[model samples]
Target: MAAGLAVTLATMTMGACSGERSEFDTRNESFLNDASPDAPAPGPGCGHQCSLDGRSVINTCTGETVQTCAADLACGAGVCQPPCAAAAADKSSNGCDFYFQEPRFEYTTISQSCYAAYVVNTSMQPVEVSMELEGKPLDLSRALYRAEPGSAEMTPLVGPIPPGESAILFISDKSPDTPLTPLESAYLGCPEGVVPASYVGGTPWGTGYGVAFHLTTNAPVSLAAVFPFGGASSAYSSATLLLPVPTWAKQHMIVNAWEMFRDGFGPGAQIFAAEDDTEVTIVPSRPIQSGKGVTGAPARVPVTYHLDKGQLLQIAQNEELTGSLVSSTKPTAIVGGHACANVPTHVTTCDVLAQQIPALEQWGHEYVGVGYAPRMGGEDELMMYRIIAARDGTRLDYDPALPAGAPVTMSAGEHVSFPAGVGEAFVVRTQDADHPIYLAAYMPGHGAAGGIWTGSDGRGDPDFVNVVPAGQYMSSYSFYADPTFADTSLVLVRAKTNGEFKDVSLECAGTLTDWKPVGTRGDYEFTRVILSRNYRPGDSFDGGGTCQYGLQRTKSDGPFTATIWGTAYCVSYGYTGGMALRKLVEIPLDVPH
Candidate 1:
């Protein structure tokens, strides 16, 4: 969940205006106006009447006072400012406030450009935005609308703008390909991260997407609103939205391999690949191949594309390898296209896949990790676990026995351990198994097991780790030289046949040192195996059917490796009895090439 958090992509800016004095809340509120009917006729020498904020005026002598008095004498003394004098003042000089309201659809032109309606309270007071559809909370978050080009910025309408000032509002239809989804609609409905915007009232709307802005402020600052005339969605591309970047914000160009190869290393590509933080300058090398059969020899190649960041044209040349050709052009983000090294000296490609439907909504990468547990019985059966965590901040603890319900809480710094009567169980013959089970003290979750020899079955210890032939009796125990130079095996002597019996391989090259077991059985209990060999981060081994995930050989003073003995089930059931011995193992991996 935290790993895939969404970030704000861009910001909007509102047009600038001069400030004017006003008497109002100056918060996110509006100014008010009132008129007196009992006022006497205009005093002598009064040519016209003007509102105190200086927006409209009425001519007293010319009889215009009777018609425009509503706007001229809203809330002050009859004499306030004379209308004739107010008209002489520049409209830009008068301060008017603007804020965003409903994003309702207005009329549209034949060209499909949209006109939208937005109400702003110029009354000099802040107002909370609320909406109800048929008396129910209206989820307008996914409401289809977009601001015209250059409408990406917003300014606060409460402070600083001169009184009687007017700002703009723009709205339209944009980003049709990526229609708003239910999840996004839900997110927008919450209003946790919504930013205010500003624009010129009555500004004409365009078709293509550019930047759209709103208004906001932590302190008092004068501002106005912008309501553009168009809001429409079209199949063809047009300049509907153009977002502006602030001087303090950081901008990045997401690039893909194909786009780099085909577009000839465009500005976005050069910036992503350039080293030393140096400016990029790319040029055309040779004509890039367009067909599937085309290939390039390893050498420095030149390419070109048109774009610039921070007012500078980006340019650079890249060294490419022959027979290792890749796509020329790619999207801003590629799902997966990287590779890592393997043991015995080899390479493997990894593809990042979408774990959920609708790839645009969810994306993730997968990597293999090894898991080792000695036995299962009593309370150990209910313990649920998963090798990988989900993007939703939840673990996929899978167990076959437990029913799915609320997540079971585990005590802090506590782990369940089997004291006696329980034995280690393992699924062999396969390397992939996912299931849920209940360990008496624990609940169920996701887990994987089994993938060794396809048809061969595996076994586990029913009573103890590495116990052999529980029913029959044996009389000898010994440690011999390893047959395999780098491998280790577990050997049992004078052991029982039916109770706990398993034939395990034991091989090592150096002195026996640092050996430990899980139970009181001493040498018979399940203990971790150690080997002396330096390993890199990603190094791994098949372990035949015996191990998986990341298996590493560590570097130590001696050549000998340690391992646990087998279980009685193995001697009776053979390989089908599963792994009789189990131990927690830590291996070092090799570095990626």
Candidate 2:
């Protein structure tokens, strides 16, 4: 299975490099030395090392010379390069071509009268960013600068951020004297003749409500939406790292469940329709906490609703909605998160958690399950994962090294999960290529009964994260850091026999260790490197201070997947979660025969 996919990827690599020079003369000596003798040589019918296109050097399967570089690059020095050093000076003209044009944030709520969003320039150059509110250009002045983490004061953003740096944009509600129009009121879900509760005087930002924003930047950048509660000292916050609109979005999704009943906080799914007049149908596997229900049999019951462009619907309920399926007439973006949850019931505090749900079309057959560290002063915790099948007859194969009892087969729309001991990771793959599945890892939400919470705490309120599949993996990626989190770590997974890390850079944080294997799952190995500010004291969150915010970049010689895990704790409330490093959206290297 791996061999077939590798060859297809090579063909794709060739297609991308098809426009280079047509002749492979000795002056390009680097090409000959780079070509592996074991790689397929040109077939008997071919006479030269370069394909007829003159771009590529040689084909791995047929041994024929082929173009493997993009048009703007030159096949030289054993790799794609610019014709001149000056031509390659700009990062955007090289391999950094993919970008998100319209990145959307779903839950921008006002806390203490102000809300904030962050933009990190992932490119090597400066970027000009603009904001859009309800389809209109928002005045840049409305956005004030919130200080980066570990800083003492706030300032306005008046210039382009240097490469690899970040800027915060704050939005505050307008005064009540400027009443909202009926149209504006409707958009905010406010009843007629009344101002939205969020905008009313003395209303706290944590009114169980939020607004949406659409951000546009001239260069590729990662975004984070943050809401803070309480005052300084016991300042608690909830944050969600946002994903830019990919080149393609799907119309179907299998919604993952948020752990229910952690301090009475329930799980919810927020669906955003990006297109106008989209008809959405939602089938719930369990009843919702909002007192909404369908009349038909449970398996056949579905609630249908229509959404205009940029509108969103959120469903929070008491029951687990793990198996719920959402479908729309057009493409849409969805997010799953807990409104406020404790890792375990009876814990000291609970906070918000959210992750953007990848579309079903992006789901793959294989995944490596991993989780966050146990709560402070607590023993290792058990991690749980849910596997959902997208098609009929999905047969699963787990790493035999894992503890027994993981399910081996699943039917269409079927979902199941099992627990693994702390720090233990495993791989799961479908037996065939036709049936794909989605996997989600749940971190232990509850802490030891006597430790954090006074009451009994077993599994804790597990924060759910969508595990990225190997098929959706990328050789390069960039992600934003949760500046407010006290601690953060980078998790890396690669095929044990096939890939190796290359050029891993943690912008502002220092690497605690080199790449080291944490576990083996079949042919894949999980490795991790701790990333924290230079001042982090040991592994404890208490001494890490506020995490410094910046963009992180990681690349590998072969395909690999990764995500960042973060934890924030205060005397009053605490939370933990993770998000995928955004893979540059480009033409997939895998080509189906």
Candidate 3:
């Protein structure tokens, strides 16, 4: 399966390079070191090899051979660059067709004040992003991630978002009681008038609500929604990467962090359709809420339903949805998360959790797992990681092994989890390409029961982020780190040899240095960097902000993936920095016969 796909990817990759690259088919066949072996070896000072493009050393650049550093150490820009240094080699999260679901919270709370945070325009050309409901576009959007609620600043998108930046648009304020006395502000987050009156979210459980965003760009871009409910202590805030349409699949298995919170947000899956009359079949691992046509179905039994374009089917249940199966007749968007959750369900506090389910084709056989930075206690905390198998008898081999009782194998719809200590990393590989699996990383709240929750003592609450596959690593990323987050830090992994060059760099922080290899693993290394402390809007800007998010850009010499995390005052948010969104398999959807 892997070899076949590689051939297909190579074929799809040939003509896609050069000129303004499209969002998909950006793959480039590596031509580095492909020059004839019969060619004479260069003389001294040939270490700094150069090329006209990124892959091959076969082209010419202004009377200079773009191969093996024949003469000069390096050539001019766009002339002879280093092998694999072309921006096209980056497998980034730039695509259209994204889905977002603001989990239900108290209608009159901060959670109701949701926004489409961090809509990154990763292209050179400006791009526009808009929200669509029930198949029609909504005239609402704004450019503020941490705006003062009720400031009336979160308005509909005004103009095109500049290239290589991010924008935050006010999604909606579900409170019907929003103030109206000549701009009278309700205690909720935003005024009712800010969002369309008809589009009411934060609805009661069992009332499936659907919302989608349509980006008007063929250029590569990425997006996420910030559900920062409440403020200060005990608040629940988390974010999810909005996988683009090209990555959407006909089948996906659910992976909720943990069981739901009693009388609070529970584990659930949100399904959205882009085409009308789409039939969705779901076999629950846990019983779904007995309504919305789910009244008679039980766990482990397939339940089918039909939905139209821009419609959503939210499956909420008292139990976690991990290990469940969802398959659709048409390409569909699926999100699985807990509105608020405690890792292990007994951690000190709970935080909202959401991550878009990558299509089966997006699942990878190899992964690198690393824990977040050390906590305030000075002890590198233990992070949690879960792997869900998409196929039966999927054997797993862990480099440096897992602590104690981590599973070495998983069956389809089965999930295995373990704790990762500070600096400890796990490089996981399955038996073969046929045994693909999904991985998710989670940071538990500061402590278990009896831990401090005060403003001055307690630090991070529970947070969640998807573990992108090594196959999907991108060479560059244009992402965001909300200034509202007190601690904005980055965690990333790359080839060990790549780290030896120390080429990773951030926009504001300059070049990244000191990469420690993962465990005793010789294949890869990982590192963490703090972007800002107690980030305040406008306090730290990249000198560009017209709906473009913080506009932070990070690049490397080779393919790598990073996770951006923010933690402070019992609230935290995390999401994959960016990815190439590579599809690995082609599954023929067999709609109910």
Candidate 4:
């Protein structure tokens, strides 16, 4: 999808190839020296899936079956995947192994949630995925687990997540049909001119767990954690798609937002180790809370500790941890955010914020920023964005021209904030791929600057989202949408294939009819679609609301990016639906000479 930057990797061979020989010449030479017409006919097996007839391999993708690889594509990963998919993080999320951390979520009052995971089977064959909890107190009384409305049940599910169907593994209550509310939560929306929890500096009063789950990722599947129930379990509701352990790395930077009141936890970074005796180090962007024996961590000072497999440690304090660097003797995953936060320090309503931080290596230099759907105000919504530099002298340039007030450069570990208005699509890029940057989109508190902006979801609060860069997009995606909020929508950015825009479709909504063209930096475009709205909280999963939450998939002839957002009264959660955590190189289906 990043045609402009991607084309560079494809051109490196040219410098020493002016004397290149044609395919015919190469073939002639091979024929002369290694002719073998007497050999037997070629077999039907593909290289990776040799057991299956390459002529009729399983599509593996949703709603598709047996098919041969396209002429230019090779059969891999059980289907005809572009050569580039071999090393990208897109398909990596569906591996047969995954390690998930049951994060520490805090609230102001009566905080209790059905901690669960929404798992979607992305493989063709049925797979029995199971879980092994790392922490105890493993009591399963009235725990909700269901895949269909008519077949709701309590206790652990009998079978797998099931192919083509989605399953919610609830940790409490048996409500396959409904979610909790804020007033129901005995919670209050953040008010303007209020002191944040970080500034006020108090201990976390909300419920939090130190558990971890080792999912037998057998068969391909993708997962997302719905904070509590899919509903406004805590109008402080927030959720994020979880990346498989295979996509995690040895390094990560905690991306934090403005903190909340002193009651809940302030800006923090939680690190989970996958191996025993993993020596973890944290260079805090702010003072670190003394917890779990990490007693003397301070801002800018590196702290080291050991964690066995399945153990998690949260380092938090009164200051933000946005640029903190987390390194480990082994690969680890870091979930960063405030238990609840004001998007900007000067905002009103606060919302829970958290996202699995991608390893620095997975960051990209190019991106397209889009705001969450605008259901609260029929008009296009505005978003605040942050560009974090992973390397020094990271210069940023905006397509069509840099927006005023936007910084053109940033230093390593430094970040800049800028506003992106409605109905706008702009391309942001660094000098090259080496200067990768991380992008985070933010929704300011509804009562930001003391201005009233309330509607369908009530008085919305501040929220944070990790923006998936164009360079990390994959052709197809199978993600989850929480049906607990009043509204849910998607933001998609599509890049051209062979110099022309290709169509992208959402499972709930067919072919997209509206797309705003991104500048002339290359052939790029973006669109915002509201998947569901005006639905009562917590009823979508039970067939009573306007939105049905579950396995939501999207596809295009070429790679593209997608993000999902859910909004409730004074509450919302947003996260990129999926992305390829960069690893391998170029992805040109048709590499040129």
lDDT of each: 0.19, 0.45, 0.58, 0.56
Candidate 4 structure quality by residue, lDDT tens digits, 479-558: 77765565667778887765577788666566765688787656578887666555532222222333254457787766
Q: Considering only N, C-alpha and C atoms within 3 Å, which residue pairs clash in candidate 3?
A: 91-580, 92-579, 92-580, 94-221, 141-156, 142-169, 166-548, 166-549, 167-547
- What does the lDDT read for residue 346 in candidate 4? 46
Q: How accurate is candidate 3 locally (lDDT)?
A: 0.58
- The regions of model 3 sitting more than 4 angstroms off are 1-92, 105-111, 141-158, 175-199, 202-204, 207-215, 229-234, 263-265, 293-296, 377-379, 448-456, 496-502, 536-549, 586-593
Order the candidates by TM-score, highest first: 3, 4, 2, 1
Per-residue lDDT tens digits of candidate 3, residues 1-593?
A: 00000000001112211232232222221212211212223444233332422223433213244454322222222234321122222223555446565755323222344444567776555665556554566664433332322121334445676666566666655456654342222123533335532235633454355555444444446776666422233256667777666557688777776666565446666787878899988887766666544453677778887877767777666667687778888988777777567665555566666777777777777788887766654334566777788877776666665454566657888877666565567777776666788888887775621222222245566777888887677566777666555666778787533224336766665566578776464767887776655544322334542121255677775666788877666667788877655555445323333
Clashing pairs counted in every model: 170, 24, 9, 11
Q: lDDT tens string, model 1, 476-547?
A: 111111111111223222111223323323222122222333222221322233221111111122442222
Q: Which ten residues in a row have the lowest lDDT in candidate 4?
A: 1-10
Residue 103: error of model 4 in Å? 3.8
CA-RMSD of model 2:
13.1
